[model samples]
Target: MKNPVPLPAYLALCLLLLSGCAAAAGSPGSAGPPSSASSSVASPPGGAHAAHHGTETGSPAPAPAGPSEAARMVCGDQPMDRLTAILELKEKPHTVSNWADSTFTCTYHLAEGTLRISVQQAPDEASARKYFDAMQALAKDAKPIEGLANLGFPAYETADGSAVFQKDSFVLHVDASALPAVAGPNAITRNALAYQLSTTILACWVEHH
Candidate 1:
């Protein structure tokens, strides 16, 4: 070799070469420096989030059920029709019904008077018979209605023109004290009308049960 290079000049040349290599590595033509990957994510469409979380979006709950068949029979349209036919009601009577203490009561308000029907449901047949016997014993001159024997067990007419009878665990009473008088002088009596109403109700019970 010719002349030896100075120490300072040699060190400067090495630093310049290192800087050029770094710039070339960062350029568009070369691979980029190390970095973290993208961290973003996309969501699903249309209530998919709710479905994923076990929820039904935009839906309503179901409705509750109505009254029982027995309650409807004791206080509904069939008996009303029978009352109209037997009493010859010119106008539709105003009606009200209630249920309490295992009993159902229905009252019809007419222009001339009121008609009432009551049904008591006991726990067992023995309890119903006991109650029926007690009612018969308490009636003011209770008389067994031979004609209504087919209607209920030991049917009877009360002193106040009502009919009381028992069948199975059911005790029924039809009070016709204020029924309107029919056109004929020999029209059916109130007691007979009570019996007729009881017969209609018993037929309904038999049909349903």
Candidate 2:
């Protein structure tokens, strides 16, 4: 070192060293604490993050209930179709159903008239027989139905074209009196219609049982 450096040159060299040190500190590869935004993570949409944590955000919907057993017996497709065919209806009848106090009733509104079917379920066979016998006794000019005895025990038709019968703990009544009278030679009467309807319902009961 023969000659000393000038004061301005020495100052400029010191400033260049200071700027290099500052650039190194701010470099992308430098080891430093992460910023607040860089350290935080965002969750996915539609509760997916909650699902990932094995948590239940909500419960699935429950399934709908089905029709009751008694309602199915009279209002089912088979019996309804049979009634439509027997009445010679151009279109399906409008139907109304009611269930109360162990009794199920279905009413069919046909083009010409109304047809009603009622089923009363007793606690036991004996109770059903007693109720049916009382009803039979109260009927005016009730006659025992010959062919349908096998379908329902002591089946009968009332003077008003209502068919009544009992099987086990069930008593069924079919009332077709509101229908118009059949006029043609081969036309079916209301009494016969009631009997046919009763047969169909009893067949359904046997199949299900």
Q: Give the top-scoring candidate (TM-score).
A: 2
TM-score for predicted model 2 compared with the true structure: 0.62
Q: Runs in model 2 with CA error above 4 Å?
A: 1-71, 147-152, 183-186
Candidate 1 residues 53-158, lDDT tens each? Answer: 2224434222112213443454555667656765576666777765444455677776657777776555445555665666677677788765324333767776
- Tens digits of lDDT, candidate 2, 10-56: 33433343332211111111122211111111112322122122224
- Report backbone clashes per prediction: 0, 0
lDDT of each: 0.53, 0.55
Write down the TM-score of every candidate: 0.61, 0.62
